[model samples]
Target: MVATEVGDKRVDYIPGNSSIRLVDFPLKDASFRSRRLLQLALATIPWAEKSQYLLFPSIYELEPQAIDVLRQELSIPIYTIGPTIPYLSHNQVVSTNHDYINWLDNQPLGSVLYVSQGSFLSVSSEQIDEIANGLRESGVRFLWVMRGESSNWKNICGDKGFVLPWCDQLKVLMHSAIGGFWSHCGWNSTREGLFCGVPFLTFPIMMDQPLNSKYIVEDWKVGWRVEKEVKETVLIRRDEIARLVRRFMDLDDYEVKEMRKRARELQQVCQSSIASGGSSENNMEEFLGHILHGAKP
Candidate 1:
């Protein structure tokens, strides 16, 4: 779970640690050579040349300790201010006949489930089938948004599962009918879902997803995670998936009551953060001020 970033090295306009960041993807093998090269390059960038830093850190920094480690590691000024989501909240249930909206209204509240595999992280046909069977067995109506070209979903399912390429995820989450999300635990999606008050059925596919999943079920008290990776097979367990879904979706009145409470708190956070005078809102004002004044920071 403690893996590094993926892909080849790329350049970004940070102040420090900005000297040719090498992306040893999956971080599986940092390749001594690549690491040495990175170190050498970093060494070349004069410390005085570095002044400001901007970074989008993981939501794991929601913990105080994680925040401290980042502060320690990056001596130069850096902003670990993220899980930064674009949020929109409404108290009034306005009706716009977006087809999805009508369908959403008709379904039972806290019943129709949502399944979205992030833009990355595709599975095999077998894996898709396993997911389909698991959802079917769980007896939950769902909307599964699958990505990629060769999912090979012949007879895969959309009867009870309204399969779509993509939808307004935030809108879907806010719908009265949506109960739980079956997700790959992408931080952005996770943030939106949390703000919308939907508990998650988390299946972390890669990178910091496992960490994100941990934050949700363990730290945030928002959702449950399915154990990924297997002893014998590469495929996720159909039964395990079903069990997790059922566990997460078991809407006892008390639990639902608490979840609704959680949702409202999250909504408050988003509302204030985006409103004209709130944290992110104010931060944006200062940011533009700097830009207009010419990157003073």
Candidate 2:
């Protein structure tokens, strides 16, 4: 249900599939931003109406409260599917014996961490250096992607890590050597870890990252957040960073194994869903089945 809180509006087009993405909304804030977004969505609603499918990755997105408001107040037909990353991995990423891939191959299983912030977020030189220093001091083998910040972090313990400008993220995570992910907990990355059976060393940045982190650290029991800062001045002590990284890497009990098993099961289910007769497959089919089922366009 959309929040009656916002005066009918649409705000943003969330990324991921057109189908799933509701659990990520910070609803109270979006209500305030809805008016102009309402204008934006209205300008496109006519075009959207002509289209056969109604997909909103995050229903809570773009004043979905308003969309629910409008849908309930009027009668609009919009259908939703779920956490779409699992269903979207038909694309294969091959990581062969490139020097980087080869380097990654040499690390011990459950011994290396994969750290990145996707392409959209950038860390300051200090933060990058701090992390690099931490990883180096931890004596960990890592495949870190620090794109567009060559000068920011190149000098800090360069050889102990493979600091690529970017790498095939999916391929890196799927590697057996990757024990955990040091991530921003973006939905795609969070879901990627879930899919690959790699746990997380979460350093959530903004928006849904914090919420996704909660599921990882608290609900799932598979990950932990690195640090909490009031505004921006948080020192990254090399020892503490190493300690948490070790915690995520440490698979001491049946607990880690159980979580890994669950992740694998979900991965299988997710893979199955995108195939014929699976939930995502069926969901897509049913949506297509109704194209001319006498509903008003």
Tens-place lDDT per residue, model 1, 125-199, is 688778888887777788777765424442465456676676778778877888888888877888788767787
TM-score between candidate 1 and the true structure? 0.70
**What's the C-alpha lDDT at position 102 in model 1?**
68
lDDT of 1 at 31: 50
lDDT of 2 by residue, 79-132 (tens): 544436632332332236466667766778767789998776555667777788
Q: Name the top TM-score candidate.
A: 1
Overall lDDT per candidate, in order of appearance: 0.63, 0.63
Clashing pairs in 2: 3-65, 9-38, 10-37, 10-38, 11-62, 12-62, 20-57, 21-57, 21-58
| Candidate 1 residue pairs in clash (backbone atoms < 3 Å) | 6-25
